[model samples]
Target chain A: MKSTTTWINSINNRFWRTIVNSTATGVESVAVFRIIMGIYLLFVTTPTYTWIADLPKALYTPPIISFVNLLASDFPGRNFLVTVDFLMVASIVGIVLGIYSRFATLAFVILKVSVLSFQYSFGKIDHDIMLPATLACMAFSGWGQTLALVPDKRSKWDSPSKSLSVIAVLIGFGYFSAGIEKAIHWLNFDLNSNGTARWFYLGLYNLQRQPILAPALKNAPFWFFKIMDVVGVIFELTPIIAVLISRKAWRIWLFFAAAFHLVNYLLFNINFIGNGLVYIAFINYKPVYRYVANLTKSYIAKALILAAVGYAAVIRGISILTSQNVGIIFIPDNGNANLYCMLIIWALICAALFITIFKTGKQPVHDDLEVVSPQLT
Target chain B: MHSLKFTGILFAIFLIPFVLRLFGLEPYPAILFPSGPETVKQVNGKTEIETKQLFAKKQNGQWALVEPKAFMYPVSAIQLAKLVSKNMGFKKQKPFPLKGKIGIVNYLYRSQNSSSSAAEEAELRNWIKKRLKRGNYQTSEVKVATYSNIISTTNGNILKKELKDEKYYNLD
Candidate 1:
């Protein structure tokens, strides 16, 4: 009787703790995520909704949620969409600057969903839902409490916010759903039903230009792709499990997730950079923020880095507006260019990880927050 | 009690969509990846994969190859191929009498019929017309053709590509 009571109590404790505990490091960590995500939205993801607006109206097919159609009686005109796009940029600037951050995030989400829904109405749905979802969650996360020009006194900077935990759960389930779909299709005993190879062939047949690694890997063994298919499904299905296990497990899962996206980009030319960036919410970003702060003690060095990023963002913005072909690093429309960009990104990530692990020695313990499991806490 | 309620709501938000999707209902927003080809077949003792390509007739009375990616900005090539081969058409239905606006609008439209709808044909014609105009060609007809991508089972080189079924759509 005593042992049974102990087990039940443990379960009860876990259930409540998992629900109530915050997964984030602090307000400063969320602030960093807001700034980085803002820059990514502004520069890397150039919405071609204005171009989409030009497509024939006969092709407009509403998504599963049809009420979106009622938002506008008729399909929006190009000028209207362009205005919305410009306002979206302005909102992103507000988010980055931490000026009325929640309002900016909310505005951005509304405008983004409006445009993306119209784009998807034409019969193709891109898996870019996470970005808007993350923005919505961050709107209420109290991220602006730390870095804002006018920070809210009500915002608790030291206490971990539950918003990150919510975002993590959303991402975990998103990938879990995708994994279930793949498992249903690819788990058959047939060896020839290699999902990766089939996607590669589809890319070759459909794309205007061949994927970068297609020439080299066209003749790769059938077994290799079959292995990749199995591994991909496993990676997708395990995120929720990782989340329930511990924070260390979740971080390790993220490392693999990054590699998965990079490989997918190289082989299939599919970009999931936005979804991958959302993974930052699950990480303990306090150490990373401190490291960056220590390195940028000098104002001149900080200004130089800021200027460079601003310049690149402007160049990317101009290229999108003018529809001109810039260098592969800027646009990365082709495979070779994508490969180089991926390599550079991976290198920088590795360098950051190395510095953080060695220089920081070990992560200091936080007594206030649970590490996704009771045992760890 | 409030914390428990919030946690319960969060769990429902994540799990409800997943459960709906599992039962083949997509009433909620979720991430979906394109499913690849179903199977690889053996033809004449060689491995074979099949895919579809799109072509548009030019003013010179020749069928020129059309890259769907060029005209269909965000649509995947596989999706375009499926759309072309299946000849799918959307049917606009009357809004159902439901309690909420969302529920009413949700049932307002669906894809119906194996045969092409006027809207589908018009959309295709527009794409073909735009593609041809870029190359300074005037044409009103497009073709959806299937090709067998044959590969060596021993070595991975593609041995040959053989064209199979051919379907044409004329806008004139």
Candidate 2:
């Protein structure tokens, strides 16, 4: 009896310690997440300027103002919207530079939500949601402290552990909700019109409107899809499980997760790159960070990272400019040339990432990036 | 903020909403997944390829096909789609007779929770009724119909018997 009680007590202690200190060693990984988030958000929101600039004259009634009776019927006009666009750009810069990161993040949250409310006021709401959610978490976390050009030095509450802990839980919770929703869907599956998983699967295939892939998916054996759907439900729940398990289990789960996303992308053109990228928060990247830091100690690594970032920026700018008349001087003259440029850019990024991760001959890369949770009374 | 306070605040933000969820109070629509499954609408019959363009408005006490923009000013065909999804339903409208002079609005609606939300339906109808009344069209009876395909709007004078020929409201 005493032995069992002691074992239970030790387990309880260990669990809390893991929760409290899971983030102590994820500063570098969290930094990478922050930088990726900043760049992605800027790229994502760049297209909104055209619509935002026409808000005053645009037909759809902006949100919040619609339900309220006393708000202004007349809009403030396109110039005012231009000011909003300019401010958004400035905030994006701040997010990237890590200068006043908290403020920039808050500004981003408010601005993005405010504009999105207007943009979708007429009704399509699911586009580009991951960025805002990501930005809000980073704003809540002190992620800018490590990787920013000018790191915020507020030491009181900006510990890596606290910041990362908050982010990890949020991500875990997000995926868990998705998994739960799927379960709820299947719960009513029996009562649905056709009363089977086939209807549910067909609904998911965009009502058989999936042009290229629909025929194959339809022709596949019914048992095949039913089993895949069941597996998908379990896999979706694995994200939350990943957060709760040991580091080794978490890594294994994430590997399967990457595969799941890839398969979904192929089956449906629904690429959730932004959502997938945020999962890096759970990884212990101390070794990766250390290697990069060491490599940066040599000028070659510094130049390489800078080159990667620069190439990434130019590619981003060109893609955005080509799609919209953003008034940029340099435009991709042709689609084939632009595609080639993108491939080269990706290759460069991969080379930089590979060298930073494995090129340092001082030590071999190991799979033991586990962080020890400190016992706290 | 001290570390404990920081931790406390963060957890509070997470937990309060969770507790609210337990009590059946969903958080404000923000950066999160739907609290429940957002089932993608599936229509069995031939559906209009461009859904937002198909709409039927009640004019002169008769349901007639009309352009969506006539009712939802400035809402693009795509924007109209966003509005139809209950989850994406846009809030806020310009105050004065929201989209003035438009009466007896008509548009395609694909909503996940519309079947269950009678109160939501009543509230919207009342709002639209008030708007239509101000625009000099006496209107009554806001009824919603779901159909798989709405081929095209017929000419203003088409008889009710001709609706089948126009492919309007042809539910499978």
Candidate 3:
């Protein structure tokens, strides 16, 4: 009995230790993640709910959420949706600036969900839960503890925060779930059950999303698609285990995951770039933050960078409002050339992240005795 | 104690959904994909697949093939199919103005708007017109149809297309 008890205690100790060590992040790291996510949401993932508002109410098939039916009964007006869009933008700005960031995050989450719920009510439910889930987790995290006008008082800046670890676990389990679903449905020993080829055909014929590689890969061998199906299932299934095992394992898995998304985009024109951006939570950004700080020590350099970001944001906002087809860099279109450009850009980003992870090595664990970074303090 | 409590909460949050999904109840935010059995099926020694297409009739009295993407804006082809099969008469369900009850309650009642069909039809026509206007064609009618095709199971090449159902709406 005593031996069993001791074994249980050891396992519990190991689990908690792993969680704490994996999530041992500096305040600057979390702050950098906040800024990066805020910018990504503002420019790349800005909700175009105005078009959804114009959809006929007859098509409103509310999701499982009961409150959505009530909302659909008195469907929101176009002006109301536009106002929600603007408020979402304002809250994103607040998140970037770290001014009442928790509140800003909460507001953004509420507004985003409200609008997206209505959008999904038109019988199309997109699996876009990651961004909102991340934002919800961030609202209660130490992301605003550093580089903030209003840092969260409840957060212990010097200690390891559970937020990043939680996010990593969430993403891992999400992939695991997908992997399991595929395994159940796609793992039959039949040669004809090739999920990858099926999706490729669907995109090519039914969806009219002819990416650059679609034509080339159309006549590819059945065995090639079978291999892809196996690899994809394995890739999705291993993330949770990798995260729990070691930081290096997690980084390696993430690189492969990014590659997987890129491959999906290449063949199927299905974009999961938002999910890729959410992987930023798993990175230790303190070194990057420090490098940028050192590079922009001059006041003029800082001002210039800020101006550039602001100008880009303003231009993106204008493009969205005017419904202009902002080039494929910002919005992916049906152009083959633009598809190639996006692929190259995404590949470079994945490579850079992989290099950064290897170069930085393991993040240091924070304990009561460890000295906090001066800049963070 | 704090770590234990936090770990417990996290486990609960993740595990509940995991367990629920195992039982086939997809609670909100469940990770799902639209992959399943092979679409190509062998029926009576013949391999075939089902396909859907949207077509528009121009003012020039010619029916031109319309891309499903042109008319199904802000919704997927699959979603449009569901809306058509369920709400529209495509699947033989009473066309709109459906009367139903909420749960097992005695007093709670629900009724679809009578104008819903007309409104939805009008919107679909507008979408068709907008898409055709880009190509400098004036659309006067639209049709949503499904086809069953004998296909090459090896390469997914269609051998022949047999129209299954064709629903037409006059824009005039």
Candidate 4:
């Protein structure tokens, strides 16, 4: 009887703890999601951006419509899709800045989904679907709960808390949805015994025909392709098992799925519905921040920030003086590089924030803040 | 200690799908083509032979072959377009017929008109006798030759006459 009571109390504690942490995470996510959407919109619409029309030509469907093909077609005002893409980007930025976030989130969801759907309207996969879903969740969840603009210490709605739970659930749904899609494709969907090899052969043939990567990927053999095909199938199917098992399992599943998506973006130059965005949505944000904070020694945090700032200054200075391109040690050209740059910049900013907090004698932000009601206190 | 281990496990779990994706498993959608018919017929006069058509139609839950008598091999659009362009003498080559799109052509097989006198005559007589049996046509005006598994039907078209195979026909 005593042990049962103890177990019940533990469960209750866990439930309440989760509520508080999720609330905080949800608030943080609004900022991140908004900024990301804005940047993406701006980047795609940039006049100097050249890759808009240079997608692999082999991706053409005989009976179905394709975005690239549509762009090349006699369709009127087709340029409006780019305008919508830029709007979504702007909306996300607006959302993150906590400036008219509700309206921004709604606009972002509508424009992003419509354009992506119309672009790949012949048919689209999970990546295309997930972005709109994320935006929809964000819109309803009151993601920007703790905004600098609002400056409200005591609020009734607990907006961020509600949003966090919704976001986490949606992110989980994205994985579950992908798993479901894979199950559909794999059920009695045997390409034949030698189908795997044939599939790889077709992929390689398609890759070799690509104007950009043709020279590099053309020489890869049938055996290499066969292995990749089988392995790819296994990766697609593994997530279904991963997300349901445990919290640890979900994290692993999400990480590898993100990496898998990243690799596809890099090697195959596929970018339609990217995996990274969906992966971010699935993450246990509070735990991740806590874990990273714990790993950084309180002493070295300042030095790390200084080093980063110094490195940035040196790179900037060298670029300005030489009038020659710096041979930076990094992934070059390709769409993948932009994502990598975003990740780096985000990490650097986070690190700077952490150092500032420590130096100013301010406590690291707690995963949960319990604001007692005036009447209770 | 437990939290650290949990964190490590979490990271590993996340990394697995990505690693699998990197090595070549994509979580993207599969693209497929529509089924079409098996047999195509080109009826010119009383002589009828099968012509190759592009797509097959799915009827009553079964895929019916479009050109039943004519064997179909998956041919690339570019190759078919080139063949048609060369024959038709188009100013510029057009894009090939797509998967669901069908292309129709009027094709004929030809036999030799040669100086190998006696042997050619014997071959033509044998050819005429075979077509008479298979086609069941009493018209002796149509001369037939069986060689290279091809049954040619010629009706005094010089273009058809110019193109000859291993078989022989009499100059009647």
Best by lDDT: 3
lDDT of 2 at A329: 16
Tens digits of lDDT, candidate 1, A58-116: 55555554345545433587678667766776687677666688778899999888777
Tell me the spans in candidate 1 whose CA falls farther than 4 Å from its real position: A1-23, A69-74, A150-153, A156-161, A188-193, A207-209, A288-339, A346-377, B22-28, B31-46, B58-60, B73-107, B110-124, B153-157, B160-162
**Candidate 3 at residue A58, lDDT?**
56
Better of 1 and 4 by TM-score: 1
lDDT of 4 by residue, B1-172 (tens): 0133433553454455434443433222111111011111112411122122122223333323222112111111222222221221111223433432442210000000012235434444453334333433332332222111121112211122122222222223
lDDT values for all models? 0.61, 0.45, 0.62, 0.36
Across A1-377, the per-residue lDDT of candidate 2 in tens digits comes to 99996776666555434543433344465566666566655543244333433332222333322221123332334555555655666677677657688788789777766655555543344434545666676664566666666776644444445445455566566565556666666433432122123332433321322323444654454445445655776776675566566444444555566556555544553445555555454444555666644654676865765565555455444443333332211334343443344334334333433343332222211112122112123
Worst 10 residues of 4 chain A by lDDT: A54-63
Candidate 3 per-residue C-alpha lDDT over A285-353 given as tens digits, one digit per residue, 9 for 90 to 100:
766887754655677966775675576567656544654434432456555655666676578658855
- After superposition, the stretches of candidate 3 with alpha carbons farther than 4 Å from their true spots are A1-13, A149-160, A295-297, A316-341, A360-363, A368-377, B1-48, B68-140, B149-157
Instruction: Write one digit per residue (lDDT tens) for candidate 1, span B74-158.
Output: 4344446545644432234433335325644444443321224576567756765765577555566667788887877445566
Measured with C-alpha atoms, the lDDT of residue A153 in candidate 1 is: 42
What are the clash counts of all predictions, listed in order?
Answer: 0, 13, 0, 30
Looking at model 3 chain A, report the run of 10 residues with the lowest lDDT sum. A368-377
RMSD (Å) of each candidate, 1 decimal: 5.4, 11.4, 4.9, 21.2
DockQ of each: 0.30, 0.11, 0.29, 0.02
Please report how far candidate 2 places residue A249 from its true position, in Å: 2.9
Off by over 4 Å in 2: A1-16, A20-24, A43-45, A53-77, A127-130, A140-142, A187-212, A290-377, B1-31, B34-80, B83-172
Which residue pairs come into collision in candidate 3? none
Per-residue lDDT of model 4, residues A82-170, tens digit only: 45544654564465445566677788767654444333322222244555555665564444443323322334433443444444444
Considering lDDT, which of the candidate structures 2 and 4 is the better prediction for this target? 2
Ordered by lDDT, highest first, the candidates read 3, 1, 2, 4
Task: Give the Å shift of residue A299 in candidate 3.
Answer: 3.1
